[model samples]
Target chain A: MEDVYMGIDVGSISTKGVIITKENKILSSEYIWTEGNPIGAVKKLVRLLEKQFDKENYRIVATGTTGSARKLVGTVLSATVVKNEITAHAVGTTTFHPDVRTILEIGGQDSKIILVENGVAVDYAMNTLCAAGTGAFLSSQSARLGIPVEDMGEIAVKSQHPTQIAARCTVFAESDLVHKIQVGHTKEDIVAGLCQAVVGNYLNNVGKGKKIQSPVVFQGGVSKNIGVVKAFENQLGCPIIVDPDGHLMGAIGAAILARRNKERRVFNFDVEDMEFITREINCGGCPNNCEIICVYRNGEMIDSWGNRCERGDVAARKAANPNAAAV
Target chain B: MDEIRMPKAEYNHHEMVVGIPRSLLYFRYGVLWERFFQELGVKTITSAPTNLKIMTNGSRRAASEMCLAMKIYMGHVESLIGKCDYILVPRILDFGLRRVMCVNFEALPDVVSNIFFESPIRVLSYNIDVSKKLDERRAMVEMAVSMGFSHGKSNKAYKKARKAQNEADSRAVKQNEAKYKNDGITLVLAGHSYILEDEYIGKPIMQYLNENGVNVVRADLVDRKAALRESERLSPTLKWELSREIVGSLVMHVHDFDGVVLLSVYPCALDSMVNDMMLRKNRITHVPILQMTLDAQTGTAGVETRLESFLDILKMRKEVEAGNGREAEA
Candidate 1:
């Protein structure tokens, strides 16, 4: 039987799953909206991927998880390899594109620029505080412009003269874009300007104090935008490569990481009949009353988080064993 | 009609109890702390001394950017919240005697209040600025008056507390002096002794180094005159007494030690910036320097590894220099 590895990228916006053969061929993949429920999304993703591939043909060996929801998913799935997004992204991109020197990733909420030296990530910067150069920003702007988000790239391509928008911050860029539109700039010109502003903002904020060299691989959801890709190439004076499976790179990275780990664990992909429930509680430990989230399986509290103390741990343990004395 | 009875003014008679976290100013003014409340006829409850549990608790609640001391202090405060009626978290802006703590220290009460807004425990605070003739006595008197004590009684309490605090501080200074004179690689640790004394946060690092045969010296252990003079050499314009003392101690003893370890708490904006500047400007090329940031969640494993690596680097440099000297002689 052929061996298969499982990779899960449990992000805030979406949860992605990928099943790969021993030789790293993508056998089955699925993406599902998280909808603020990471556990539910992972369960759905696992069920979807399992349906596409025959369990008999490929024996599951190892599992890896990445992204913001990586820990939650990993805990739920019992993943063999749990890694940060940086390591997973670098591993995934480098495996496919060995000669790639840089990776520019702009996701739904965050943007990051990873500098690779001989396929190793030497330095990387992530913009977690701002939302200026992200997919959410673009989608909101597209809605404001009365254009479908999917049509933004194609419309931007039609501009004869693109207007220059401020790319300092989201507030500044929005006002600048609105001002440019008010001054009677064409919709296409404004769209093109918006694309340019995103690239500029990313380069200035996330890509600050770092050298961004080419053979750059632009991945993440925003990489689907040809307008943004063209802006990156124009600004950096270098060709940008966007993988056809760029949206699934994090998942792909996770898959590759799972394969690399020698530990083999049999994964029971039979998630169809699994019962899971989530509950939220407030921990009044100190002045910071942290709202804790607890996940239960078969009426047994499996995991709890959100509280910044041992309170969560005690609560989870107590919930699991009702007779246990409270700490 | 029944006659209503009010609460008695005697300290022993009072049912209301105040809790004090002995982490930050607790180190600086423990005697004054106990004395002031005692004189005011109020019961004071202090959190247990710094321990592993407190450190772990603090680290979990504090943000990633907060300094180790603040994190530990928060932990201490957390321990006292439910156990006491009110936590005495004074906001000492300035000493009025040219000594001012970091802005973070000044804003600690506000930070604690904001961080623990949901907690039922009340926080009692008083602002002190000696530069504006706002001395400790005046501050204590004001605190007492606010708590419903009469002006004459508050004044008496303040004087008594002040006297007790001075004696305690002097005794602590003497003990530290004795501890400083021991044999081995004498390191003059330059931060607040309170931070250095915390068992879980700062003390373990010192204990580890000492157990490895390196003698520990505290910046707080040195004579005030000598440390001040040494600080003048490093930076003539250095103002804060504690910082100046540390810098002075480093300058004076940099040649005597093999290496220097500068320990700072996380989110300490003043120390982070000033200490980095000191490390850059100092011309002590022969000695190695290690800057460690302490937070509530400081893993002993990581710190141990760093300390081991730093020590190895110094050892390697020494061996190389010694070999070079022998080769030149031959």
Candidate 2:
């Protein structure tokens, strides 16, 4: 039977799943909105991917998880290889495009520029604090303009005289956009200008002080917008490569990592229908008072985190022996 | 009712005590600080000794990319929030004379205020421009005036406090000078004295080296005048006052010391750039220099291992040199 590897990218905004064959051929993939529920999103994604799997030919061997929710999803799915987003993305991208120099990734809430040299990520910069160039920022602006976010790119292409908007921050960008609209700028021009602002903001902030070389691949949610892609191409004076499966690159990367790690461990996709109860408790050990989260399974404490120190061990121990005397 | 004396005019009793975390500028302006606050009649509270809890808490509160010292400073500020009416987190722009602090120090007050917004501790600040004659004296007077102290009282207090602080610092400098006069492998540590005094960060390394029979000399322990002079020999263009002093001490005592350890906080942009330049440009053939960056996550075990290996290398080199000297004598 052909071996199948499972990869899960559990990001803040969405959870992605992919099943790939031994030869790195993507067999099945699914994207599900996290909806603030990672566990539910994973379950839904797994079910969708399982439906598309060739059950007669493929046998699941290993699993991998990446992104912000990697730890939680890894624990849930029993992933063999869990890696950070940077390593996973680098590995996944280099496997396909070995000579790729730069990887520009702009997602729902954050954006990152990874500088690759000789198939290794030498340095990288991420913009987490700013939201002006992010997908969420675009989505909100789309709503204000009474335009569907899906059609933002198409509308941007129609703009001949795009309005100039301040892209320093989300607040400044929003006010600038509003002022431009009030001054009777065409919707196409405004939308196109917004896309340009995102590209400009991203370059000025995330791409500062870095040598950005050619053969650049722009992936993640924002890569779907052709306007931004054109902006990058024009600004860098280099062609921007956008894969058809660019949105699923993170999931694809996770799958590639899983396939690489499958030699060590075997995986089964039959997720146990176990209910997990998560609770948040405040740890008042110091003035900082970090609020810790404890996860319980079947009336027993399984895992706990959020407290910055071992002071939260008391909460964990208390959860373990509820009938015992309190500390 | 007929003899009700006019109630004393309700004096604005808005007395606020500002707490300054004694980690960064505390060593630099110990005298100036005491005098400035004393002149204004404002109570000052400093955080307790640096401990593991403070370090951990500070790291958690700070952004992932902040330097190690700033994180510790945050923890110190967090400790002082409820204990004091206001935290005297002064935003220093420039010291004039082309001397400037790290960008992190300039943004510290703003960052701290934003980070701990839930806490009701007020921040006090003063802008210093020596070029405009707005010196430390003017800064203290301005701070005092803002705090409702009369200009005359603030000036008097500033003078007295400045005198007291200078006297105390000179004594410390003298003590350190005496300590360095001993016959031993004097390792001159060129870094902030607070970093050396910090329990979780610098104190451990100092204690470990001392226990291993190595005499530790602090670059910050030297006289300011002598250090400045020494620094001129090392780098004529070294603009940072603190870094100049450290480099100056290293140049003067490089031959006297067995090895030099240039300690820096993690993610420190200015220090990393300057220290890297110093390590590359200086050709001190006799002494080996170790560049170590301390962060919140830095474990003592890792530090101990590095120190042990460096010491071993130095010992082996010394032994080989001694053997050659004996052979030459024969």
Candidate 3:
């Protein structure tokens, strides 16, 4: 059997998992709603992917994880490499498009722009201060418009003239969206306008002051919408490339990273059967009051973090050395 | 910094408590100002650490256009209302003719006064206008006189407090310099002392950095006098006193740090401009920068991800540099 690597991206809204061979060929993949439970979501994702590829054909040698719950899920899986979404996305994109100079990723909760130089991420900016230009905004708007998010792209592409909505702030975007609806604008035009607004807001805020060189690749959950892709191309005055497996890029990147590393953690397929539990405990050691997540396998603690001071070590080390905290 | 333990000296002046809102210049001068009051036989109390309630209450009272830090400061001032005899909201004016603090700093006292116009809390007034020859020492002296301290007592108190502050600043610089000797990644958290030292605001970032196996050296840890002299080359016309030091620290110790993390509170007029300017100057350098803007809405997940990515990038670069050195030697 050939060796295979697994990568799981347990994001806030959705969880994605991908299995790939040593040659970068994706053997199996799955995407599912996280539904506020990352571990359960990832387990279901893995179970679904497990059904896609025959275990006899490839042996899962190592695993990696990324996204908002990268640390938590990485703990559950005992991943070989736990990377952030930015590095994962960069590696995933550059693996396929080595000459790609820029990557514009608008995910469910946040958006980021990665500037690549010589096939490496030189600089990047994630939407730190606001959730103005994100998939959540579009999803909420889609609900308000009584249209499925999946069909929003087709409706937007049908619009001959997109409405002009405010793209400065999320508050303004929401109000402007309602105002356009009250003014009797066509649904297609309004939907297209939203795509434009998201693009404009992202460029004005997250992409502000960024040196955006061409051969730009746009990905993430937002890339699934054709309207957003068209808007980006129109505003950038250049073509925006959208890959079919854009949403799985972070997972793909994680798998690639796992393959590059010298050491590998033997992945257990029986993670689905194992008892994994998480508890959030506040560290009272200092004023930082870091809410640490303690992960336990069966009755034993595996790992913990979230403290900023040496005082918090009593709580963090409680996982492996249970007697350290003195109960 | 809140993490650093200062002298535990206390005063028995129970008649009055001076409320110091832990925002703006408080991080830099809180210890000295508090000590000066203590020396003059006056007790001092600071507002509780920043929280959502303090932040929202402040935002509601302040103008929408005010920066996040200014708004948080107002909230802190509000927290001290009716709890103390006076609230210290220093009116720090221009440093010199061409060198100035942020316009917000210059207008902060007025802003606080207007916000609490109907309230009973008396906002302490200390005008630090070095451009007009009224330096920080003179302002402190005048403030002490208004509080009924004798000229000789005030002079002694100021000297004692000044000595403590100077020693603390020097100690900070020395400790930061020691971090340079370590063979690992070091990040200079470039921001105003207030934004960087606030337990509720800036402390978490420092904590995260510490836990992530990176040493954090505050840009303000560098001596202001020396930093100002070194900063003139970066931008001679950069008027903001703090921003000049932030930019200057890089020029002074650019090679010491593996990367620069330009941390700022969201909606800061001074920081936004300075961050861009500083990044532009260091564009050609190998050192990567992570510009993080913290606001009331900021979460730990986002910050952790960004910092992790930055560290990974730095590690990769270090490996590449090592490989290059080996090839060159061969």
lDDT of 2 at B105: 67
Say which prediction, candidate 2 or candidate 3, comes out ahead on DockQ. 3
Pairs in clash, predicted candidate 2? B31-B165, B35-B161, B39-B157, B231-B248
Worst 10 residues of 3 chain B by lDDT: B1-10
Report the number of clashing residue pairs per model. Answer: 18, 4, 0
Give the Cα lDDT of each candidate: 0.74, 0.73, 0.82
Q: Which segments of candidate 1 are over 4 A away from where they belong?
A: A35-37, A164-179, A283-290, A298-300, A307-311, A320-327, B1-330
The 10-residue segment of model 1 chain B with minimum total lDDT is: B1-10
Q: Among these predicted structures, which one has the highest lDDT?
A: 3
Report the candidate with higher lDDT, 2 versus 3: 3
My TM-score estimates for the predictions, one after another, are 0.60, 0.62, 0.84
- Assess candidate 2 and give its lDDT: 0.73
DockQ for all candidate structures vs. native: 0.03, 0.02, 0.26
lDDT of 3 by residue, B1-330 (tens): 111111223212467788999788887887798889889888788898876567778888889888788888888998898788678777788878657888888787777878898998767777888866888888888777666667889888999999998888788889876777777778888888888877767888888788888877888778677888888888888888888887888888888878888899878888888887776676556467888988765347777788888877666556555554211210
Across A1-327, the per-residue lDDT of candidate 1 in tens digits comes to: 877889999876778889987667899999888889888889889889988988777778889998877766877887888766766787788778888888999988778777666555544556634467898889889988999987898988888887898866677878887888888999999999999888988987667556678798998888888899898999999989999987788888887778777777889875546677777876555544456778777777778776545776666566567687544
TM-score of 1: 0.60
Instruction: Order the candidate numbers by lDDT, best to worst.
Output: 3, 1, 2
